[model samples]
Every structure is written in structure tokens, then in C-alpha cells.
Target: MFIPAIMAGGAGTRLWPLSRKEFPKQFLNLTSDQSMLQQTLARLEGTGHSNPILLASEKHRFLVAEQLRLSNVATSQIVLEPFGRNTAPAIAIATFMAASESPDNILLVLSADHNVADVAGFQKAILKAQALAENDYLVTFGIVPDTPETGYGYIKCGDPIDDNGQRVSAFVEKPDLATAQRYLDDGKHLWNSGMFMFKANVFLEELKKYQPDVFDYCQSAFNNMQSDHDFHRIPEDIFEKCPDISVDYAVMEQTASAAVVSLDVGWSDIGSWDALSKVLQKDENGNNLRGDAIALNTKNTLIFSENRLISTIGVQDLVIVETKDAVLVSHKDHVQDVKEVVSTLRKNDRNEADSHRQVYRPWGHYDSIDNGKRYQVKRIFVEPGAKLSVQMHHHRSEHWVVVSGTANVYCNGEKKLLTENQSVYIPIGAIHSLENPGKIPLEVIEVQSGSYLGEDDIERFEDRYGRVD
Candidate 1:
């Protein structure tokens, strides 16, 4: 049986403004209506695969589960990492979990944030890798490089092991432009796709030989794991003490059993804004415009407006993206440097580096509409039958006015039902919880007045979704 282990922990910083720390690009629908993570799961449909095992960060556990549920992909196990410890520990934990299914079960490792246009080709490649994996080779699918892409790392291919496999020579880091061109000209280099297939025991053996310390730490973590529903929580104290390193740096690059299988499926990692623009459809004038937008004389440009209209008269080879709180406008060639812009925002302690106006939670989401020194306004949307944690704030009082559906409100030990246009007030230090009692989503405008209005002021006493202290 093939157990797909989807890795969904990277915070894609290059696609900022639209992608944030709390919500990353993997959860964003970069192509079509489905998100990249959802697309990753959909790619495995009817491939004779079972429920997948997900390895994601604690911060994104709910989002991962929600997305998978929406995609109709029931996960077998959801392993939660206390912190981002890179792929070595992440894969180790996943490997240990896969072992419970069977000692010789094959794990098909895939990143949650990539797009592959040809799902059939991907499945075909997986079949080939599975055949090799059954023979104990640690096989990774390498994309046949279509261009001299300096952004992606390359894999040097050695002599053919069989008619369909080649021994991996070395994993090369991102090269300079000239070297990338040289790599393309050499005819022996392939882009490191990072997708792999390995027997559970084979991967564990390689880990033990190449990275014994990481193997030992993850072994201990797996032994101490606790399960809640479909979620598997790794022991935070010991897992946090594990080394922070990528899998390539820890074992894949050092193991002699590594093998590469060539894949020509249409693929993109979407590492930058420029990369995303390429995957989208363009107009007759070579422009990809999203949201409320009008353009004239634009050529090969990408413009996105989240909350307002964007008009461009003569923009060419540019990217103009706008959100409720931040806007990004840059030339296509310069989009890769957007990470430096994020660094600048971090240095200045800007909120744009972390989130947008809308904040997602386990139950629902809230979008800040207006704010001031002593008062703030937000539009909250609670999903049907969902409830917020029973909590109180130290310095803030809130007035909630229901806009749609029905709300079950708990305030100061009193429970009340509120319908459309009705309102309720929870005074400072009063425990409150809001629930969606109707079959549809409950929307409300929350107005807050307080000396301090930060989110950290909340004291949660009862929460269905287990959160950090």
C-alpha cells in the first residue's frame, strides 16, 4: 500500500501580502479554484492510494485539516510538529508513523505547495518509483528541466542503474545563471523535484546511517506521541530540542542508496510572484488581471486587487498586487527579491509581515474593517455549528451585532439566542463564547472598546481546539 505523506509546513515568504505567516501560499488558491495543498491531494485520486498521512506544523493544523476535509481526502494520521524543524525530522516522524501501517509500506512523499498540470504523468512516475522502492532504493522524482532555471536546485544524474533508474551523483544547490545554463547544456542535470518514494524501513535505515542523532531524537518523539481525534501530537519539549535542518542536508545527499527517476509532468514550485504569474492565464494583451481591474496597453503584466479596483494604463512586464492593508508593485524580474522587502517589514515591526486584514481561526475568520486608538471594528464569520472558545479579555469589551444566520451567545454565565440585526454586549473580564446555531455561516460585526486591544489579552478557559498557553 502507498501512503502519501504530504509536507505542509513552509511559510512561503516570497509571495507576501497575499501569503502571510499565519496563512501561507500553500493554503492560497494560486491556480484554479482549489488551493495548492488541495490540488496536491487531488492529484492522488483513483491512484489505488489510501487515506494520506499528513505532516504539518502546529500553527496550520486546523487549516490543513479543513482543506483536506473540503477536498474529501480523509487523512489517516495528522502528525503535529511543535515547531518548524525542517524536513529531516518531519520525514522521520512521518516514517515512524508509516511503520505502524506496515514494516514494508511505501511512502510517497510530496510537498503540499506545488502544482503539477499532468496528474496522469505524475501517477505514472509514482508507479515507476514504487517498483524501484520495493527493491530498497531511496527514489526521488527529478523533473526534466525545461529551461535554465537558476532558482531551483539541480540533481546530477549518474550511470543508469537499470533501464528506468539512474544512481544520483550529487544534489547541487541553486546555481548562478551561467552555471544553470551550463547545467542545462550538460544534459546530465535534472531539477530536484523533492518528491520521493521509499519503503518505510529503507528510509529509516538511511536515517540511522547518515543522521543517527536525528533518527534517535525522532524515534523518541514518535514513541511519546499522543493522539487526539486524527491529530498526533509530538512531545513538544523533546521535539523542540531536535536539530533544525533540511532532509537533503541530513541524509538524502549523503546516502548511497539514492536514485533518481525522470519526470516531465508540468510542474512549478511557485517560489516567487513571477513564478505564479506564469501559471495563470493571460489576456490578448498578455495581461493576467484578477479582481476588479481595468487595463489598457498592458503587456505581459500581472495585476491583482483584493479589496479595491486597480487600473493600469500602460504597465508592462510588471506585477501589481493589492490587499486591504498592503500593496506590492514590482517588475517581473525583480519579484524574486520580494523576500528582502519582507525582511525590511520585519525590521520595522510591521503587521503586514505576519497577516492580512482577515485573520483565520479554528472555528472561523475575522476581518478588521476599521480601527482607532480606543475602538476597533471587525466582521466575524463563524462556520455553521462552530463555536469560539469560552474566553475573557482583561482590557477589552465587545459589542456583537449579528448580520446573518443565528448566533448562540454565552456572556457572564447567561446564554442567549441572537438573530439577524440583534446585538449583545460582553463587558470587560466577562467570559464569552459565540456559536453558529444555524445551518449557514453566522456573520457579525464586533466593535471593541478597550485600553489595550491586542489579541494576546485573551484568556481562554475552555477551548474545543487545543491551543497553546
Candidate 2:
């Protein structure tokens, strides 16, 4: 049986503003109504695969679960890494888990953030890789290059093997324009798609052979994993000792059993705004406009507006993205350099680099609408049947006014049912909790008054989400 292992942990810093560290691009609906991660799971609907094993970060566990629930993808396991140790360790843990179930299980490892336009072609490649995998070959799907693109790594194919697979000759890093052209001319190189298929035992054996330290560390971490609800938490200390490296550096490049299956499916990692623009529908002027965006005399440009109108008069070959708190305007040629902007924001300790004004929580989300030196205002939304932690603030007092639906609020051991336009006040140091008692989402406007109005001021006494700190 094929067990899909979806690697869903990535910052996706290149697509910032819209994609934050807390909420990355994989969770965003870039192409269709479903998110990239959801789309990744949906594409395997008819592929006769077992429930997927999702690997995500601890901070993103709720996002992964929520997205999967929305997509109706029942996950076999949701492994939570305390910290990222790169693809090598991530894949090793997943392989270990799958092998525990059955050593002969074929694992179809895929990144949750990729976009494959041709689902049929992708499934066909998987079938071919499965055949090669059954023969104990570590198989990777190599995309047939259509252009001399330097952004992606290239895989050089060797002599053809059985079942339409080729022995992997060598893995090459991203090259310059001239070298990329040379590789394209050679016709022996393909873009490294990072999608792989292999029997669980075969991959584990290769990993143990090529990089024993990574394998050993990953095994130790997985063995000591703790289960919390849907999340399987890996021991942070042991996993942190694992060397930080990619799978290519750890095993695939060193293993002699590595093989590549050429895939002609249209695939894009959507690494930048330019890549997203290429996949999206373009207007007569070659402009891809989304949300409340208007472009005039624009050619080969992408404009994405989330909460406000973004209008361009005469821009060409540009990407303009406006979110709640940040705006990114860059030329298409320089889209790859957008990561440097995120790096700069990090160095400055700016929160904008990590999240937006609106932050997602397990129960719901809250948007910071206004703030002052001694007060703050927020718009909070609570999903039906969800409740906030029973907690108290040390330095702030809160007043919640229900705007829609019904709110069951508990303040200072007093329970009250608040309907539309009704308000409640929780004094400083008073234990409080908010719940959505209605079938629909409960929207509340919150006004806070405090000398120190930070999120860290909350002291949780009880939480259903298993949050302790």
C-alpha cells in the first residue's frame, strides 16, 4: 500500500506579507479555493493511498489540523517537530513511523507547498516510481525542464533502468544563466521536484548506510515521541542533536540505489511572486489581479490585495501585494531577493516579519484594529463550539461587546449569555473565558485598558487545547 507522507513545515519567507512565519504559503489559497496543502492532499483522491502522515512544526499544529479538517483529509498521523532539522531528519522520522507499521509499505513523500497542474501526469509518474521502488530503488520524480531556469536544482539522469526509470547520475545545485542554458542544451538534466517514492525499509536502510548519525538521531527522537491529541511531539533535545541538512546531502546523493523518473507534469514550487503569476490566469494586459486590485497599462505583473484596493496605473513586470499590515512592491526580475527583506525585518526584531495584525489561534482569530499608549482595540472571531482558555490578565482589563451570534462568557466565576450588542466587562485580575455558544461564528469587539497590554500577560488556569505555557 502507498502511504503519503506530506512534509508541511516551511516558512515560505519569499512570499511574505501574505505568507508569514506563523501562517505560511502552504495554508494560503494561491491558485484555487483550496490551499496548496489541501490541494496536495486532494490530488491523491483517486490514487488508492492510505491516510497521509503530516509533518509540521509545533506552532503550526492547529493550522495543519484545521486545514486537513476543512479538506476532509483524515491523517493517519500529525507529527510535530519541536524544531526544524531540515528535510533529512523530517523524512527519516516519517520513514521510521511508516516502517513501524510495515517495512514493505511504499511511501510517497511530497512537499505540501508544491503545485502540480496535471494531476493525471503526476499520478502516472507516481505509478512508475512505485514500480521502481518495489525493486528496492530510491526513486525521485524529475521534472522535464522546459526553460533555462536557475532557481531550481537540477538532476542529471544516467542510463535508463527498468520500468522507465533512470539511474541518478548526479545532483547539481542552482546554476547561473549560462550554465542553466548549457544544462538545457544537454537534454540530460531535469529539475529536481523533491518528490520521492520508495519502500519504507529501503529508504531507512539507505539513510542508515549513507548517514548513520541522522538515522540514529531520528530513530531516538521518534522512539521517545509523546502524543498530544492529534499531534505526535518529537523530543526536542534528541532531535535538536541531529545534524541540520537536506535529504540530498544526507542520503540521495550518496546512495547508489537513487533513481529518477522523468515527469512531464506541470509543477511549480511557487517559490516567488513571479512563479505565482505564471500559474495564475492573466488578463489581456498580462496582469494577474486578485482580490480588490485594479491594474491599468500593466503587463506581466501580479497584484494581490487582501483587505484594501490596490491600483496600478502604468506598472509592468512588477508584483504588488498588500495585506493588512504590510505591502510588498517589487519588480519581477528581483522577486527572488524578497527573502532578504524578511531577513532584514528579522534582524530588526519586527513582528511584521513573523505575523500579520490578525493572528490565528486554535479556537479562532483576533485582529488588532487600533491601539494607543494605554489601550488597545481588537476584533475577535470565535468559531462555533470553540472557547478561549480560562485565564486572567495581570496588567489589563477587557470589555467584550458581541457584534454577531451569541457569546457565553465567564468572568470572575459569573456566567452570562450575551447576544448581539450586549457587552460584558472583566476587571483586572479577574479570571475570564469566552465561548461561542451559537451555531455560527461569534464576532466580538474587544476594548482593553492597561499599562502593559501585551499578549504574554495572560495566565492560563485551564485550556482545552492542552496549552501549558
Candidate 3:
């Protein structure tokens, strides 16, 4: 049996407008009905592994918790990094956590946002790698490449090993078109998939030997960890000192007992629009159309619309994605340059670089429907048994009309229960709170009229999420 640790912290810049810094690709439902994170959790089933230990950024704590609750995964062992220090420190922290359980337990490391079409093949490869891990080998699953793809690094395989695996002859960086073609022709190279397996203690020792400073910093941060809600947060100042490097550089490249298992599982990282288009199902014209899109004379294109109907005419080799706040139109060949748009947006202090029009909170979510010079409208959802903080706004007054279920409104130390079609007014500077006391979800339409309608105008008195003292 092995323990799984899923790394979920990443900024998917190429998939912007749909994926943001606040909400990345892992939390998106790109392929199926479930999100990639939920699918990763489901991938653990039938493998006889323990519940996964999720590692994410501190800002993504609620997202991690909500995904776990939605998937019915009973794992509360989430480790939150202050900020991303790359994979080495993250895996080091996970290794230390897993070692606390048992040093001999194998830890299978996986990314939370990878798409694998062949689930059975992936499980089989995991079993193969676990056998090598049992023999003190640092095993990484290498994807058998079908095409001369230059986006990924290649791994050259040596002689066969004991567990249907091969010794890793060398790990090569991303190659040019000619080198990639040569590697494909030689048939001795595999794409580095970044999935690894080894005993918890064995990985810790390898990390300590090669990257000693990183090892020391991660161990110190882990010793100073704090348990908050359903997550474990490493201290910010200490974790920041950990080197910003990947596990491939810190341990895998320097390890002596490295092994590679050939896996042909139809895997894709979904890194870019072109990569995502290749992984998704396509029509006869080689087009993948999602969500209220109508295409005419379109071929080799991808159109994704999140809100309204998007009709395209005479488009080829293109990607057109429409979100509530922004839209991205680009040629498929230049999809990798989309990150330049995100960089420009960030330089201009644009909120679109970080968030969507709809924002999620610990309680529920709210969508901004309309906004004018002095008035803004929001469609708010409050989950059952969830409550907003007791706070007062200095510059805005809110009018809330309950559209569904029930609401308990507390304003200025007075409480009132409101049902469907009922309304309540919260004047400016009135200490107020809202809660859903019923078993069903409560929906409300809130209209705010104020000189300043920004989100930073509230002073909290009491909060359940530890946002305030």
C-alpha cells in the first residue's frame, strides 16, 4: 500500500480568463462533469492507496476543502504553502509528513491537473513503479511518446530493471524540433511525465543528501507547521527561504538509483489551449466546441464559451474562448505566447489577471450581475449552515431580497428570519450578518448603492473562517 500526495498549486497563464491566479486549471471542469482535482481523487480508487495528502497554496485552502467535500474524500491532511517554492520543497514537506506515519510506506507523487484517458494503464504503471520503489529505487513513470513533441523533456532509458522497468540513462531538457525528431526516431527516449514513486524515508534521505539547504529549510518549516481548519499551513517567512527549484533538479537528476517505467496511458498535462484541444474529443472537422457555441465552416479549431452564445464563421486553426469578463482569440500555433497577455494585464493592475466576475467564499459564491456608476447588483448563494461574517460597511448600504429558501439576518443586535420573497435593508454603518438557517441553499439578490463599492470596505467583528480576530 502507498500514500498519494497530489501537488495542486500552479498558475495556468496560458488558460487565462478561464483559469486565473486565484482559480487555476486544476479546479476547472475541463474534460468531464467533475473537476480535474475530483478526477485525480477518483483515480486513486481501486489502487489500495490511503487517502491523498493534498498540497496547495494558502490562498487555495477553501478551494481544496470544497473540492474534498464535494468528492466525499475524508482526508483532512492538507498542507498549504505560503507561496510556491517549486516541487522540491513541496515534496520534501510531503515526504516528512508521510514519514511520520511510517518510514516504509511508499509515497506516490502525482499532479492534480493531469488528464489520463487510460485509467487502467495508469494504475498498472503505478503498481510497476511501486515494485521498484520497494527495492529502494527512485522510480519515475515516463510517458511513451507517440509524436515528436518539443514541449516536454525526454528521458533516455538504459538496460531493463527487475520490475518491468529500465534504468534511467539520462534526463534531458526540452529539445528543439530536430532533436525531438531524432529522439522519436531513435525510440530510446520517453517524455518526462513528472510522476514519481519511492518510500517516504528513502526520498527524505535522497533530498537531504543532494539539496541539503532545501532539506534543512523544509524540515524546519514542517516542524513549525500549524493546523488550521482542515489545512496545515507552513510559516511564510521560513518557507520563503526554501529554494525555488524543481524535484528533477534537486533529487532526481542527482540520485544514483533511478528507474523509469514506460507508460502509454494517453496522458496530457493540458498546459496550453493546443494541448487541451488535442486531449479533448473532436468533431469530424477536428474541432472541439464547448458551451453554447455554433460554428460554420470551422476546422481544426476550439471554441469555448462560458456565458453566452458564441457564433463563429470561417475559422481554422484557431482558439476562441469567451468568459464572462474576458475573451481570448488566438492562433493554435501561437498558443504558448498567451502568457504574454497575462503579463501585460498584470503590469496594468488589471483584476482580470487574477479573478473572474464570480467570486467564491468559504460560505458560498457571489456573481456580479450588473454594476453602474453608483449601484451594483449581485446574485449571492449561501450554503446551508453557513454564515457570513458580522461586519459593517462604511460607504455602502445593502438591500437583500431572498429569492429562495430561508435567511437569518442580524442587524444592529436584532435578528429577523426571512423567507422566500421577503426583503431586508441594511443601512450603512449598521453592524449586520447573514446566515442560512435551513437545510436548503438560500439565494438572495443584493443591490448596493454607495459612493465606493469595492470589496475592501468592510470591518469584521466576528468570522468563522479566521479572517478576523
Task: Give me the candidate number with maximum TM-score.
Answer: 2
Please give each candidate's TM-score.
0.98, 0.98, 0.97
Model 2 segments beyond 4 Å from truth? Answer: none
RMSD after CA superposition, every candidate:
1.3, 1.0, 1.3
Candidate 2, position 41, lDDT: 95
TM-score, ranked from best to worst? 2, 1, 3
- Per-residue CA lDDT of model 2 for 246-266, tens digit only, reads 999998999999999998878
- Sliding window of 10 residues with minimal summed lDDT for model 1: 460-469
Q: How accurate locally, in lDDT, is each candidate?
A: 0.90, 0.93, 0.93
Per-residue lDDT of model 3, residues 227-290, tens digit only: 8777898999899888999999999999988999999989999999999999888999999999
Clashes of each: 0, 0, 0
Native-vs-model 3 lDDT? 0.93
**lDDT tens digits by residue: candidate 1, 1-469:** 6999999988888898888888999999888899989999998988888678898888898999899889987775998888889888999999998897687989999999998988999888888888889999999889998789998899999989886689999999999999999999998999998888999999999899988889999999999998888899899988987888888888889899999999888899988888888888889988888899999888999998888999989779999999899999999989988889999999999988988899989899999999999999999999998999999999999999999999999998899999999999999999999999889999999999999999899899888887635
